[model samples]
Target: MDQYAVFGNPISHSKSPAIHTMFAKQTQQAMEYGVIEAPLDGFEKAVGEFIHRGGQGANVTLPFKQQAFALADQLSEAARLAEAVNTLSFNKGRIYGDNTDGKGLVADLKLQGVTLTDARILLLGAGGAARGVIAPLLSELPASIHVANRTEQRAVELAVQNPSSKLVASGLDNIEGEFDLVINASSASLAGSVPSIRGPLVADAVCYDMVYAATVTPFNLWARQQGASRTIDGLGMLVCQAAESFAIWRGVRPDVNPVMQFLRAQMTQSL
Candidate 1:
């Protein structure tokens, strides 16, 4: 069987092994998927050894996405624009990288019954997670997109990275008015927290927290109390992104709704 895996530090909690395993069975592909605990300083070497052992592909997370971007012999257009790689494929002594996070997020929103065309979007965060999705988000041609970050400087810096559309950066404190969708791409929810921002950003908008939980995440919960239309966590995004990578490897697109439903049940049971 061909081997595939996800590489990261602090990977004991990852759901990828299970997600990919299920995809393999569903798609009837002969592949072995698992998780790899790559040392912070040893990402490249670990990947090198995996390829040597016939590893066919990898899903990267956290601190390694940029390094994976640097390691790829070639990158897809999305990867080049995001400057990050969450998916990888090996071929003929070369490694290829792709960023499926943005596509995943967009797909998740669609699964949640969202209509993205010509709508206002507020993206919270200016880091890699946020960067990976901006190009795809812009490609949808939202009426406007305002990126807000706690560190206003970083948000401003990132806003300049994608200059082709209706996008700009603002300090969270200065943000005013409403949006059609407010996506929390920040890692703040991992700490059981929400972004510190004024109330207007989320009011009347559907809230999307890129962090998922058995129950509504803190960000989504707070958005609910604020009278947001609806709230969705990141479980769907996770499944959608995984499907993208699976398609890249197997040339088959597995339906993610079933996979997402399963993961949701697992998260609920765990809690």
Candidate 2:
């Protein structure tokens, strides 16, 4: 059986194993996927052993994304641009890395009826997650894209490297104007918090939280009250990203819509 695993500290909460298992069963692909509760200092060793043990590929998460990015033999353009690697494919003694988070966000937005083509975009946060998605988001050619972070310098630095699009950096408080789409990529949402940007920042916008819970996340709740036209959590994005990795490793793109709906229903029922 082909082997795979997801690496993280508190990985007990991760849904990647179950997700990949579903992908495998749905496609009739023979594979074993599990979780690796890596020690804070042992990500490299854990990944090395997995590849050695016939592990075909692995998903990197949390504090190890930078380490995975540095350890890869090569990177996909998306991974290189983001300086982070969330997915690693081992082949012929070489490891190829790619960050599927951005791809997942874009595809999830499409499923939610939020079109980025020619629309104005407002991306919150300038951290690794934000960096991972910006390059792919720019590929969609939104009319304009603004990156606002609590730490202004970080936002400025991220904007300088990504000058291909009409990118601008601003402090969260200085965020002005409206956007057709707003993505809350900051882990703040996962921490049960939302950014402190003006409520008007989400006025008339379609808000997306990159973190999902059994119920709507704090970010989506705040966004909805700010006149957001639509609000969604990250369950769809998580499934979409997992499907992308499945397609990369197995060459079969499972219809994620059904899986997404299933997960949403499960979450709703649990609440």
Which runs in model 2 stand beyond 4 Å of their true positions? Answer: none
TM-score for candidate 1, please give it: 0.97
lDDT of 1 by residue, 124-184 (tens): 9998889889988888778988899988988888888888558879877878667999999
Q: Candidate 1 — what's its lDDT?
A: 0.90
lDDT of each candidate versus the true structure = 0.90, 0.90
Least lDDT summed over 10 consecutive residues: which range in candidate 1?
A: 169-178
Clashing pairs in 2: none
* Decoy 2 TM-score against native: 0.97
**Model 1: pairs clashing at backbone N, Cα or C within 3 Å:** none
Which lDDT tens digits does candidate 2 get at residues 48-73? 88887899999989879999999999
Model 1 residue 28 distance off true place after TM-score fit, in angstroms: 1.0
